[model samples]
Target: MSTPVDTPAPATTGAAPAALDVLHRVFGYDAFRGQQAAIIDQVVQGGDALVLMPTGGGKSLCYQVPALVRSGIGVVVSPLIALMQDQVDALAANGVRAEFLNSTQGPDERRRVEQAVLAGQVDMLYLAPERLKLESTRALLDRATVSLFAIDEAHCVAQWGHDFRPDYLELSVLHERWPTIPRIALTATATPQTHREISARLGLDDAAHFVADFDRPNIQYRIEPKAAALQQLLKFIRTEHAGDAGIVYCLSRNSVERTAAALADQGIAALPYHAGLDAGIRARNQSRFLREDGIVMVATIAFGMGIDKPDVRFVAHLDLPKSVEGYYQETGRAGRDGLPSTAWLAYGLNDVVQQRRMIDQSDGDAAHRRQLSAHLDAMLALCETIECRRVRLLAYFGQEFAPGGRESTACGNCDTCIAPPEAWDGTVPAQKLLSTIVRLEREHRQRYGAGHLVDILVGKRSPRVAELGHDALSTFGIGADLGEQEWRAVVRQLLAQGFVAVAGDGYGTLVLSPTSADVLGGRTSVRMRREPIRASRPARATRRAAAQPDMPTEAVPLFEALRVWRSTQAKERSVPAYVVFSDATLRGIAATRPDSIEQLAEVSGVGAAKLETYGELVLEVVAAAA
Candidate 1:
């Protein structure tokens, strides 16, 4: 039986006219994105809200502007200390009275912040959920007047979310403690079910719910099946975006270190960032990535939540993310400045097995595991799909893309659009593979991994296949028409489409999913791509020419000068220059020839510290060049 869906109630009230004036005065913007104005208005009017906006969709302003305009302090509950510090730093740089209470602070410092809160001096106080459990913290919260309680990363409250925390489950007590205070729960990534879980867990029964579209129009999405993934990653980085600020995400800490080292060896300025690194080093590396340009931060998923860097040109995944929501959030870190960016991912059958094994090992409830598996299946389908990757991605998030419309462009700059491959009929091969699975009694027995199965079918008398006597089976040698690479591709596509599953044991054997019966029953047809031969390397001159931008001849020298200056500054500071000023920022400065510290400060990366440190030297260089 289908369960009835509950309808959302209308917002409790409207925002005050005074708040609108404050928003313009502080934020320097006239309006909000999507439902931001309405959400902010509701929050300002002392009504609870649950906001689910995509990354780079102005989730912060929904709470920030209201917190500034509202009467009392806005208490923001965040999960990560680094994220809280980043947000607080950015807000303080904008002249907002923001502070954070987390493990980083001493008791005396915490007491000072509490005193400031009690004195109504802080407009916003960011707290880690763990900090809320302290006796002193609860006592302060009991007495202090809070205009609104904001939960950032609200999806963490849901068990089905990729980054769930148990402390978030206790947040519902906020409503019981401070019944009159308005609560605003905000997250950049959450599915429809996750949204419901968050709303329920936060005790936001009468909250105004706002779900902005999850599609990131500026990001070009591409998925490549795993074969020489590292080489492909290097080619993409070197050929398309030689020196752009980007991130490379891995599924493991070891992979992060290895990939970072490999990129550095190839003359790329890369750094490893994971929980294993010391806190100081991680902070420095993160700051360098945020402040510098053209730095490739190879990190696990720990690196990019709440990162406000706007011009990250690319995001590459060395492994598949846990779910589509996680993938979207991680990829959304790029192209945030409304500029062109790329989201490239590489996956294989091994990734599927490992991910499935992870799900089986997790201690989540059955419903949560089922939901996660469904989400992962959707992600795998996206990876294997020959259709527009952006369309499938949006559909997973319950959003629709325009058919054959400009909105479907996906930047007109993805691998599939640029160089789509021809498809071949694979009905017979698929049937053989499915039949093999059943013939081996592999349905519940020891399922074979793709390599072993392909070896058996293609008549490669490997030691393992010989031992199993699978060469004597009727399905054996029937797939000889397909090469090893081609068979591997088919197996990957099948696994991705949920037509098969992988065993949770060490052997990582592949078993059939429920959908396999349809294929065996001749109810489905498969069309697969033939593996393309690797192309010769481009000529050196041609590669350099491709890397060069088509700037005006007069501007070229200035750009070079800026780059040289940036290189020197970066070397002296032991940081990447994009950390000093992005290429876009450099272009802006070179074009405008900002004459003073005040003018240079207006540049994106020329924050107060940078301006104070390098202002004079930059001005001298600019004046000399002019």
Candidate 2:
């Protein structure tokens, strides 16, 4: 006989509820992978946070769950209108009440969304920072029930960032205006300095900072010397990344067009995307790239911010990025779904020279120029370093990547580990270069840039050297034993080693740092990598052999089928296919061959709403494939 007892109902409110409920029931994940659960709890409890997560690190969930579980609306400030729309659509697809307000909408549309906000019908509201600065928009938000504020791409707030937004400077007003609302600022890539700047500028200085590891181990980092870059790119695509969705980033609009045309000539389905293109064309190309498979986007940096495409197998750089942050952010756009991806760059001495020249020629104040030079110098070190690229990159962000064993120290995924360059004792040439700069500074009371100084060292009778009387210096012509290339290498190493610095304004004059005295005084010896000779085609074949494709060949058909299904669903809903299900989700579905709705539910990213909406179709497809 069962005893009759009073049963208590489940308790709610006050104490933290199960975030895993939202994770599994809403987003279809079994659990929080890393710091996600902690981050979600912090925000839900009305605390502020500054999350420095890597790209595709499930950053959305940190705010999304709290937005749903907490009382009122989650206001998200994004820089791009398209990104706002895409994020909202994706949330809606996951059965979250998400809406966006942007310039693309008409008055009637805006009014409808505003009305929904007033009526408490929206869970998340995404707006551009510019829109948030409007008085009328402020009034509307003040009247509504606000839960929390999420600032996406928070690194844009840094004045020194490559993608600086003046509008982002005004975002701190959110905290002042809504003092009670918890705020979270998030970004994909930020160096230590950039991280500090973001927190201060966005008024998140008091927020709890959660920095995830910046290393993308699945990404194979390759830096090849530039010799006929177009041919090298073509060979890479044909041999290594055939039929894969990828981004080819160029430094200029003209290069974007030329690369796109060249890829097309080689029978690859390529599209050009740059600021110079007509707005309509750019939109259409971006849409096609998002919707279609086996399409390569040849673009500039303008094309990749807030791009949520997950199946990008590669991000190849035709030219150098301005900073490690830019390179990290740009390359991060690829393999976001945690699949193996390629980050390939073709760089040379010219790339270094050109990047320096651009910074010098820019019409900024001396301080601004110095800041830009500092950023570029870090990038150059990454390019020229023979150390593990992953180690160097993560170290820049203040994270140590000691992988336990000495064997683990070598990442085994970068060019350095595969084919390391011979390290030569650069002590002799380094001293020569440092002495030349010191001589110029002490004797002439003048500073010269790398180009002029290199001319002086290599015994070139250049006009600048002759006029400056640099040819008569003792250090002059002493380095003539090393050719111009070798001299440039030494100067680059000196700048990198902190033995020399770029000083003064307007095209930067070389100045000796305090550390230069050590090298000049024979207290320090610098060893630099002898740049490897350009590889022949057969040699490239050996490197290619070490690479592996992201997906298995057997899974190709099902992957295509899943893409088609996603595309169809996206079109029916008038949203992007990724809004329906990310490429990562579809790939998971294809690989697992989930034969039943129950099995499908067990897959990551298969939230309850998605299972209810597309379960039967997914099951049928899997069954037919079987």
Candidate 3:
């Protein structure tokens, strides 16, 4: 027989079995979700891991449980101080020993926290990545027995990630200082490239990787053509999802402010949130949203990185995000509580042109630019697709979707299922449009936006047409059979189908792409939707009444009273009425007849502030009505 060597003992001496018992007793949950248990077990067994989970998928428990169940202290490197405080407060509520060190903490409090860590009084320590860059912090880590290093929102380590942070690049230094410590990196969103970059940059090449399904089946995804987006958004909020907690993401700070103001004017309880606002204001707004219920936050990309709110019922994108990854992460914030939710977006040709211009203007290499363009094109295709939005979304994450896969494979709750559009063949018109673009180049050495080009094609004799003398050209008057609107629709379809390209520098001048030749030469056919004439004011009024039937007859009077109450209360507090109660919530209160404080809490959009301030007034209105 071969000489038997001494086998290594099981690595259980440092494992905190008593802490695992505490996890079960305090949280009242028996087990973890999906790969959470495996990841936790591995970390407890002294192994590093990288986890990719979707929003509301319990990515927090992967590290949270390990932090509680491991020996020594668990150091979590996070980015936002507000998010840190939220996490710490939530943990403290559950009887977990968690504290954070950042600018938000006073010098004396920081010393106390540091002392707690040294004395083994704290189970988990949360630090901003900026803290890791400090020499003093590095020295502190050298002395403390860190059981694990958890990098939350770990995608920040990659330049290609949507929310890249330069400070995260220095996280590799952790391996040098704590070579024996196990580490785990977790993020709500990351692509394969981002995953590779995170593993490489953080020196977690040998770490176990666990990627959950990217699909959020509870979220109904829908994209509408950009036509009066604010009105469409308001209607959406007022109808199916009235009185629900939601987030409306805008592309700019001004859009955030204006949209929030418009919602307020309409009697919606909403708040504007962006980096431009002071930190205290943003924090207060965020806290009000979290501690209370049914408050809609109109924000930019600056909000909701590590937000832990569970009942976010919907997320609407008023503008296109820079990439599909960004779009997915932001939209994923909805329906986190496993309830039905909606992901609504309004996109137009202008969004595509603006995104292209930003990419071309960026100071990146040619390869990077090409990659960015390809990513944007993919996102555009997803937006215009008629199939299941969830299928297309998951495919972008490298997941193969089966055809007709409806068993949790596709969310049947989207707009396509609700109201499918009619499509028509426009191959002949598409060919004519391409031919017009070519003839225009031969006639005049100039590029034009879509409007002027459509004018020339449809033979509209405007001043610009007379000045250019384009009525004399053969292609100008020949295409008058199609209406101006019809020709414009053809152009839009051509752009979406990739038969034409828009110039990046000059507000998107029309340019023919290689695919144009295929359409012009009759090698490929094109089909498009007939451009629907916009409804007039009377038609809109008729449609709105027919579309939404839940608005009770009592709603109008209740709404008026709520508005008066809100105005008086807002004047007292010196804030907007929207800062008091939204129109939708007031409508619900009016319709539901909530007469008591508990009943008022059940009203949609009646949060803590409104309940504290106008609760009595609302009850009086209900009593008077009764």
Better of 1 and 3 by lDDT: 1
Query: In lDDT terms, which candidate is top?
Result: 2
The 0-to-1 C-alpha lDDT of every candidate, in the order given, reads 0.77, 0.82, 0.76
Q: Write the per-residue lDDT of candidate 2 for residues 1-626, one digit (tens) a residue.
A: 01111111121233244677887899987767567776787788888988888998988888888888889999999997856767777887789999988888899999999999999999999999889989989999999999999999998899888799999999979889899999999998887778778877877766777787777877889887676899999998887778889999999999999999999999999999999999889988988888777789999999889888788889999998999899999999888877678899998656665666677677879999889888888888888888888888888887777665333457877888777777888888888888887788789888777888889888898887788777898977887798886777777667666677666364466777888888888899987878765443234334433443544567768977888887888788777777778876787888888988889998888898889899999888877777
Model 2 has an lDDT value of 0.82
What is the Å distance of residue 95 in model 2 from its true position? 1.4
Error of 3 at 121 (Å): 1.6
lDDT score for candidate 1 against the true structure? 0.77
Candidate 3 lDDT for residue 291? 55
- lDDT, candidate 1, 125-154, per-residue tens: 998999987777878878777878989989
The candidate 2 region of ten consecutive residues with least summed lDDT is 1-10
Off by over 4 Å in 2: 1-17, 404-408, 427-526, 532-557, 571-574
TM-score of 2: 0.83
Misplaced by over 4 Å in model 3 are 1-20, 401-410, 421-425, 458-463, 471-473, 477-489, 527-626
After superposition, which runs of candidate 1 have C-alpha atoms over 4 Å from their true positions? 1-25, 403-413, 421-424, 438-447, 466-469, 513-517, 527-626
